[model samples]
Target: MSAGTAAAGPHALEELLGDPFDPTNPAGYRAAVDADDAGSVADTATRALDRWGAGAEFVPASLGGRFTAVDELARRFRPAFRRDAGLGLGYGLTSLMAALPVWAAGTGAQRDRLAALLAAGRPVPVAFHELGHGNDLSANALSARPTADGWMLDGTKQVINNAERADAVLVLARTRADDGPERAHTLLLVEDLDDLPARGFARLPRYRTTGLAGCRLAGLRFTGCPVPRSATVGTVGHGVPTALAAFQVSRCVTAAASTSLLEAALDAVLRFAGGRELYGRTVADLPHAQSLLAGAYADLHLAQATATTAARALHLHPAGGARIAAAAKYLVPLLVEDALNDLAVVLGARGYLREGEYAIVGKHLRDAAGVSIGHAGGTSCALTVLGQLPGLRPAADPPDPDLFSGRPLPELDLSRLRLTGPRADPLLAVLTDPTGTGSAAGGAAPRTRELLGGLAAAARTIGIRAAALPAARRGVEADHRALALADEYARLVAAASCLGRYAAGRVDGSPGGLPPGWLDAVLRRVVRRRGRHGEPGSATSDSALLAHAAARTTAGLSLDLDPDRVVRHRPHPPRRPHPSRVLTPTAGGTP
Candidate 1:
């Protein structure tokens, strides 16, 4: 089993929730479409997760909860995200992301208070995104001026999730008047919003969203609101560093969460393709359709490998983690978006529907788009990776095989996270500079070795070109090339991670392991994704892998490194009044 699935082994959430197609539970796929009332739709999932004691999952064992490793944590939360991104965000992820900063720099009292809030199922909103500044944290207009007693905060934060209902707020505000780039903003833990003078604080109206309709994307404005000095997370003017460190961790988890959505989307596509008749047989039997399905399956695993490695770096190699984290955040969403878009073609007209059993597929697509652009977004993450390219050097020692060895992961210490360090990445080093026999991977299949060889060549070429650019020309002229190189490096990391998983028996020669031609299929897709001009190889080999995935998914088996028997799909029973709303019947009999 993968470390993630292994961690979720004893959990009851998956069993109780069952497949999205199940009939008995009203909260399955059928109900998900009908519960589309803007602010109230996500309540069902929120209540379910609360009942499951999911709050405990967000806290660390040392803090009196069950979080052990970042990878395992992502696995535990994937189900919620797969069901509804809105539910994941409004219900938990927002709060979890907010909690990370506190965990990283908070005092013991602050940590204790935050833990208590989580255990009580209280949502803590992180107000880092100022719509006015557009994710430019340093440019935020929200100001906190020191007073005789504490600080008087003024200014507004927009597009914050769960802003109105959160028990406490984590505010990123400017503390210094000087416009200097460093140490201008400070992070404060604002508590007891109810105690704020009614005249000083106000909640703005929630913004309607094109996606995540269930989320309350609202704003908050503070006018000289008083906050205690004890609310300060770390030292004065250190908020920028604290937030960046937290982003490195949260972004990796966010990427991992996106994979779950990809799996669900693929599940929907395979079901449609396997049952629908195209020519003489099921659409899945068609060569082109099968090719699409297998490519997507390979893509999902490749993204998972990269994301899982980045999560592992939280503890194993925290120093070089910033670049890895940015790469995951930048790559996973775009990949899953492509995967979903491909499936949309397979679904044909079904992809356009807004309500029905399969309508959740459309919702998943829209929600996935919002996630990529939300928070750090794709552009921000790409720039972060690009900025690091100029300073990167191959690691002095090769990356440890234990990182992707697919063994049980070690517990992480978030306090060790850094904002900046040497750009030497051991993971990419394994690809760029190979030791004789490739440590622990000496016995890997020849095809797998070929993948490593291709990856090494790509890295060497990218390195030479990236280094050749003068530092002046490297800024804007190199944007396209740098972004392409970042993507190539990410693919190499994914390939290495897959090889490691195979060596440790996580892939274990199963069909899920990119067996033989599957690896070639993945590399071709990667090269094409990088906009490279190359011969498009035959899909004959990948067709078998796609067929395997379709059969397994049809039987309700998971597509991760660890395969498990899953609850088979049960057709939705007749629709009842949505627990949230009573919709008038349409001209058709549906809903």
Candidate 2:
């Protein structure tokens, strides 16, 4: 388990891939493409990863592995995400999703079984969502009928990652068909798919996808499959609660991992822009290019802050953590998609090409699209937020400093995770606390005060709307102001995350923390997104922060804290003038 420490896994994984872009290396973009066609990582990469015990990060320390903290889990998985989205989802996150339920609510034997399998670098597929009822696990059609000695399982699950090759599957089935919504589903730990009797069950064929081509997206169909009663994961008729509870973890991972992928995309574009010449100057010298890079950089930081804080809140604020998780899942991926779109304009044609120079940009963009829309799409998340609006209130105290102090968290109490939490939002507290240390009275930055003011206004607006909406109209009004408040809630939460991180730094009395300018840049973007334009004393600009991010990327370091040093590609030299050379948008600035 020592090797599974926060820094160890990512460091070892990074060493395994080396510099993916190094022309002299075999494990570069070509390798990724080959893996895509084969629908798995290259044998050499897999063998190397297996040897590194990368899977141990999925198991808890008490279970003989090091899955202690959510933040560390996200950090450790960065190398996989940075390398290739298909391989990352196929090889890592999917397995984590499969194991989370057992860890959260499984028996000792179940946890041990999952821990041993993960420690051995084996795959585990979590089959939850059905094609007919996406995100609505309560409507799952799969059935586990009671038998004399066990349950007979029958039905199918679709769009599952690694389903075809999973060593075992965590299945959700309808256990009490005649029961109400809450008692309808049960979670089962089913294995021995390869050994099942003929005609009992079969693995569905893999489904091709537009992105993450290497991922084995497939389905499963069961026909009178018999399994011992021991297969039941938790209390009978509690499957819906268990599944919803587990989502708080998986959704955060999806958002965090996707953000990590976006960082790689941003790096690729930065590498290209730094090297290319536009007219008489480098593309990085163009005002539009600079602004785009700044916006993307700021967006990435905002997302990182949101993800980090929410992951911490899993332990720090267990009461309402599910909503926080939903907000992160809903908001961060969209921000990443938006960031990618802005970068696409900067990359021009390089963004469109699927192969060749800067191909990873296009590949990552496509793969990221699925993540944005796959699990609990934006609309579903909006509904989640909308439903929770009636319970929201300004926090009485400031957000706990531990959430953003960058310190280690205590062991996560998965059992403490709730399906629904009080509407109280601590992030919003940062905006409402008049006497907080960073308030304008304490001489905080003017931009910070203005941003806080905007948040206060937005909160008032949402509170009023949430109060006025009758219970019967909640669903019908969701499309109108309910959805709008949900959007604002997301932005407010993100803004609060940014400010909370900064405030935590102040609480620790740490000198030379994130500069005020960075906070201002983040808040400017937050307010702009909230539809509160032309706020007085808007952030000046993010030019300096953008330059700093570019330098960090050039040095092969991530924008987040304690960045793992990665393989940095040397910038391509400016192209020489030639009669055969074309300067169209499709022809990116340099090779």
Candidate 3:
């Protein structure tokens, strides 16, 4: 199936929200958010949730919710974000975070308890981020002390979303006093917000945020809040791994949210550009505006594809989900932020006007700023990626060949993958450096042939080594340095593919044609061989391929491809809404 095709199985939660772009019903998406009425956003979201019978929207069918498939949930939840940025984020993301601890580490009883609360229409918010410490699950300071009947929790959880209204808060706290690391902590359920002060827990006023306003992110201080022993969500001291896993899932959804936000902003900008005249022509007719539009469009598509790919990987391999999620979280935000800025450029001065209906553009741009910072910052993403890579390294034994065959390049699709156009030039420069000569290109004037041969050999060797390692360790980082190396290797491979395609095409009289099925076949064979060779061979073989590809492409042969030339430029035509008036019928138009 194509990448964007709906996954085979149940319909997604996003599919349930219906079409948000209906023009005739301009307020079809509840503008309560635009009115700056927090209560209205929350109330409208709750009504929509209940009306769609989306109680099981986030819960897996195994837990008794409507969604039996993650894809379905992702699809269903997408519309909410598309409709209203703040409400979509509050309903979809905040709720998911609130419910994740239960899904990851909750005991059967805990799961049942939390699931029941959600069913009762009480939204829960997750309290995982603290002031200074970000994504370091091991640095949490909230403490939970054991008592005869339960435990006393004391600490301050800052920047908690939905703190004022959530039925419960999943608080991560250190149970052991020792400074071994926050991993020695437990997840505790805090249930009475109204009585927080009496229990020594107080809620600070919500912080003024640029986006996701309806969230009510506030600080909660637990002076000495008490909880039953059963409040522990999972095995004590295992909270870090559980929380990390939950973070992986959350990152995927967050990326999806970013994508939705970009899409909405792009749609609005496109509509405005079409009719707004500048210099005796529509802004859309300007060359620079077209360039900006194209770049934003390409970036938005790339972000969607990358995020969706990461989501699919998470669904299939929930074990190594963290690393994949980290990659998506890091890359997608950067993509969306750039696109948002480009949209502003496309609009010029008109985009800056806040008193009008399009004020949300600025709001979204501000909201998008948080995605790459805070708990989900780039540093945190890098650390998580580093940490998770080690866990994906293959064990020191040979893995079954069949295993590698079935899981060839599990994390990336070789067929359609292209070297990032920007990186291609520098890599080519390195490969073709005159001083290095054959050392980099690995041969003489026929650089393409040499590069292809080197790529094949490296693939063969790595394939053998990978085959030897245990299947479970293949995707682990092993170390920070290893991740950097792997990233370089992936980049080099992409560059070689680009250059190789250009080279082969030149020889075949099809200057831009890529090698027919060469990339896919070679990658498949390499992975198969690595699976057979064991752990050591995997690294050795990968390094060999990198070295060879570098040498083959860097020789003095110029491929004449300009990385600066944006290839996928196109202006978005305005979307006109059907003359439908009913909300229920309009909902069905959403995909």
lDDT of 3 by residue, 1-591 (tens): 121223321123233343333322333333533534443363544465555555456665566665443333554555555556566665546777767767766778777777777666567888877887766667878888999998888889888877777767888888876646735888887776675557587778888676656556788888878888887887887666666666666777787567766766765676566756554556665566665554454455445544654555454444444555676677667667877887887776656664454555665676676655535775566545443332222223222222112122232211121111111122223224333223323433353345445553443343244344444443432444444433423323333333333223322212222122223223233222231211112332333332332222233111112111111123344343334621232344311
What is the TM-score of candidate 2? 0.92
lDDT of 1 by residue, 199-277 (tens): 8899999898888887788998999888889999998898988898889878988888888778877877777776665
True-vs-predicted CA distance for residue 30, candidate 2, Å: 3.6
Instruction: State the lDDT of candidate 2 residue by residue for 236-320, as single tens digits.
Output: 8998898778778877778888887778878878778877766656687777787877778778788888888888899989888
Best by lDDT: 2
lDDT of each candidate versus the true structure: 0.72, 0.76, 0.53
Displacement of residue 331 (Cα, Å) in model 1 is: 0.7
All models, RMSD in angstroms: 6.6, 3.6, 14.6
Position 572, candidate 3: lDDT: 48
**Which candidate achieves the best TM-score against the true structure?**
2
TM-score, per-candidate, Cα-based: 0.89, 0.92, 0.65
By how many angstroms RMSD does model 2 differ from the true structure? 3.6
**Runs with alpha carbons beyond 4 Å of true place in candidate 2:** 1-7, 435-447, 473-477, 506-516, 530-540, 554-556, 572-591
lDDT of 3: 0.53
Candidate 1 colliding pairs: none
